[model samples]
Target: MPATTVLRPRSRTLIIAATVPLALAALLADDVRVRRQLDAVPPDPTSSRTDSTTLVPASS
Candidate 1:
């Protein structure tokens, strides 16, 4: 069986440096898309209330 190759700290650093910016940019772009979608949506007047308080009598 081959031993797991231990990555050097510099390689780890390079990977982190490569990926963090891409992740951050993706997050920011997704936020912008979500904001646009939210803006496009109209407010629903009935969404704040629920019918959970309505109850039926228990059967004898």
Candidate 2:
């Protein structure tokens, strides 16, 4: 016969409490890394150019 082990409520709570901070830290680090990479790129100069084509039909 195999023996089964069960976790107490206090143990389960402690395990969950320990993981919350680690998860938050990982998310914060990833956000900072992405923001830094985005800041390093330069903006395009031609993106502000507007189209001047006319789309009206000529009437007879």
Local accuracy by lDDT, each model: 0.81, 0.77
Native-to-model Cα distance after best TM-score fit, residue 19 in candidate 2, in Å: 0.3
Per-residue alpha-carbon lDDT of candidate 1 for residues 1-60, written as tens digits (9 for 90 to 100): 357987789999999999999999999999999888876776667765344344666799
User: How much is the lDDT of residue 28 in candidate 2?
Assistant: 100
Q: Put down candidate 2 lDDT per residue, 8-57, tens digits, no spaces.
A: 89999999999999999999999999888876767657765243233455
Residue-level lDDT for 7 in candidate 2: 80
- The window of 10 residues in a row where model 1 has the poorest summed lDDT is 47-56
Error of 1 at 42 (Å): 2.2
Model 2 TM-score relative to the real fold = 0.64
Number of colliding residue pairs in model 2: 0
Provide TM-scores for the models. 0.63, 0.64
Candidate 1's TM-score reads 0.63
